[model samples]
Target: MHHSLSTGTPLRVQDMHKRFGQFAALDGVSLDVKGGELVCLLGPSGCGKTTLLRCIAGLERQDGGVIHIGSRDVSRLPPQARDYGILFQSYALFPNLTVEQNVAYGLTGASREEARRRVGEMLELVGLAGSEKKYPGQLSGGQQQRVAMARALAPSPSLLLLDEPMSALDARVREHLCGELRQLQKRLGITTLMVTHNQDEAMLMADRIAVMNHGKVEQYGTAQEIYSAPATPFVAEFVGQGNWLPFERGADGHARVGGLSLRLHGERAAIAHGRIFCRPEAIGVNPTVHEENLFRAQVREITFLGNRCRMSFELNELPGHALLAELAPERMPHLASPDIWVSLPPHSLQVFA
Candidate 1:
């Protein structure tokens, strides 16, 4: 279990296209997953993340494009010939088979001894060392998932494909299993591609994320990059929470919203009318004198989370338009009054055309 397999291999998809009659399920999707890296395909429902994963697994043939696993092209190959192991969303464990039997399912031609040894190694690797004779129905959801994972990894596949592997479990179990799966993948050094609609899951487990939309990848980057510098409005809105304010470019080159003129951080775009996007956490409460974009905000409501609080307030300059700011609970005592100063930092603002 402590040995290294060096089984990871680079996976590349180029201009992959798949269509269902007049509807396009995957439209010119392309992605690159490095060797030993965990990349998640994240999007809302009907965004083609699952379809992209299916094409890579050869479960669904693409209308056009090429897929490369390491140096071999697998576009025309079937699922069994793709040199990958897959764990489905439903676990897919045979109800009639014991845990050992399920784990040994992929060891088609191995001798009994070899299969037993491999099964033990896989089960131990997934922390199910002594649960061999138990049926899938006899184990908890998390344990059953581990059995499916062991089965998937029993063959030592070069690429590991996970299609929402933790979707069936509840929130707490899913969170726990996400960490376990990430550690296991890193320990084996396997190239992994996962499809998930849960943004939190993707952010927690993936080394990099590919945000898909309408059958296409909108952006691909690290969690911080995708969260901090989103490429599109869809990506910005989809990946995290934010507040959008409509602004007009003034004669002096500043963005004007209602009675306030704000100076932005980056080079100004050519668009005259657009929205300024800023995260709730980026809005500063009662900033210092040197700070820019200062305005008096009326505290409409405050929701106290465990460690942090979300304050909903409307700026005096932009009346009737409420914006949210997230701050630590310790700072709540300082803002006892209904009206307080808040700063919208220039560097935190993103302009969308």
Candidate 2:
């Protein structure tokens, strides 16, 4: 991971396969990234997102798969020969080298003057100006990460790969660096692929997300699409948070939940012991039901979350699973407990067969 995924044929991988004895890490995995697009390979651990990234970086040789970067079949090329910039969770900067020297590590053959100019430009680009003389040991965690980033971009590789880009930073610095990294990537127009298990980070930084599990991609779509129309139960529950209620199939495009008929988009499979999904935002409080899609529920709890409220409920029919609802500050009063009637649009409900 090569037919090009990027626009105008920037990169391509065909039927990529990687295996360790009986364990197949990547099972014919394929992906495309349009030029200048930032795609995140999102998944839980052991899903092979990192394995695929390394395959493209030419760091790990795949048992089978064709890798191409800009029309060159570089499947056999070593990591350095592929001309891709990579950043890991660890900065991996040399402790003895100064910031400028570390960033210029890949530019040794260049004249010292040229190397200095490139390093300075990269430092300024990453907001680490005036720290050229400091070594990795002397900088803060965030500063060293920026220096590593500067080093990755100093040579201007066609593609950038970040492995758990924010795993090493503290929460405060992570928030600040997330925006800075996204802006810098956009400014340079570098095609990028990052792997992360954090759903919030994926939503904030990815143009599109590919959710993986068990060495397979369970779902791939825009962050909105995966969250709104999760293809399966795994994806619905994985990306961000969602509340699901058990429902049994009813007659003619309907499922019965808590003795209520829930209209479905279409008839579900016979094996479809289904569940209805309502995004926390889709759950409403004390709304007059002028039509269908109404159910009785009891509010279990409500927690204040500053700008937003997280409301929890136990449905009359699906008492085993708790439902989460989000509300604005003004609606906090309506989040009271003890038996409440709620309505959800039929379209807002998602069912997996």
Best by lDDT: 1
lDDT of 2 by residue, 115-205 (tens): 9999988899888898999889989999899999999988878889999989888888998899899888776777888999989899999
lDDT per residue for candidate 1 within 1-353, as digits (tens), equals 34243556999999999999998999999899988899999999999999999999998999999999999999999899899999998999999999999999999899999999999999999999999999999999999999999999999999999999999999999999999999999999999999999999999999999999999999999999999999999999999899999999876557988998888865753458899999999999987565888888899999999989999999998889989999999999989899899998888999987
Q: Which parts of model 2 are misplaced by more than 4 Å? A: 1-9, 266-272, 288-291, 318-320
| TM-scores for all predictions | 0.97, 0.92
The per-prediction tally of clashing pairs is: 0, 8
By summed lDDT, the worst window of 10 consecutive residues in model 1 runs over 1-10
lDDT score at residue 17, model 1, on the 0-100 scale? 95
Question: Candidate 1 has which clashing residue pairs, if any?
Answer: none
Error of 1 at 330 (Å): 0.3
The Cα local distance difference test for each model comes to: 0.92, 0.82
TM-score of 2: 0.92
